[model samples]
Target: AQTVTQSQPEMSVQEAETVTLSCTYDTSESDYYLFWYKQPPSRQMILVIRQEAYKQQNATENRFSVNFQKAAKSFSLKISDSQLGDAAMYFCAYRPGGGGADGLTFGKGTHLIIQP
Candidate 1:
């Protein structure tokens, strides 16, 4: 079994600033995939970034990046130059490698607030 945890239920960051959302997971699988998803007011899950457990480098997509510490089982999201559009419910998710049929295991989510 795998589980993801987001300690902060909500987070706020000023416009043009940066914010980091923390996530930790427990899994027995040796190979897996970690992802950060954003769901805005539209209620659609958007894939922000993804990191493979076997990869040593973190994943990044434009202004969004991840700090993946494999040994620590920690994967945190860093949003740079925060904008109002970035405000949403961020979820950390995990899926096993090798095309496992199991769907993504998600965290409780962190609601991000952008302060202008």
Candidate 2:
């Protein structure tokens, strides 16, 4: 069984600063994909970033980046130049790359609050 854990239940950051959200997972499969999804007030889960287990380089998208530690099974999301629009409930998800009966495992999520 695979599980995702977010140590911090909630976090707050001042506008224009940087914030890193922690995420760790346990999986038996060697090949899989990790994802960070953001859910705003509207409650829609949007893909923030993704990392392939085989990829050595960390994945990044504009102001969003991930520190993927495969050996430790730790994947953290770093949001730079935080803005009010960046506030959301971020979720860490996992799914096998090859596909299987296994469904996407998601963490409890970290609620990010942006302060002006």
Candidate 1 lowest-lDDT run of ten: 94-103
* lDDT of candidates 1 onward, in order: 0.96, 0.95
Tens digit per residue, CA lDDT, model 2, 4-116: 99999999999999999999999989999999999998998999999999998999999999999999999999999999999999999998877657578999999999999
TM-score for each of the candidates: 0.97, 0.97
TM-score of candidate 2 to 2 decimals: 0.97
lDDT for position 60 in model 1: 89
Per-candidate RMSD, Å: 0.9, 0.9
Cα lDDT of model 1 overall?
Answer: 0.96
Residue pair clashes in candidate 2: none
User: In model 1, what is the error at residue 16, expressed in angstroms?
Assistant: 0.4
**Deviating ranges (above 4 Å) for candidate 2:** none
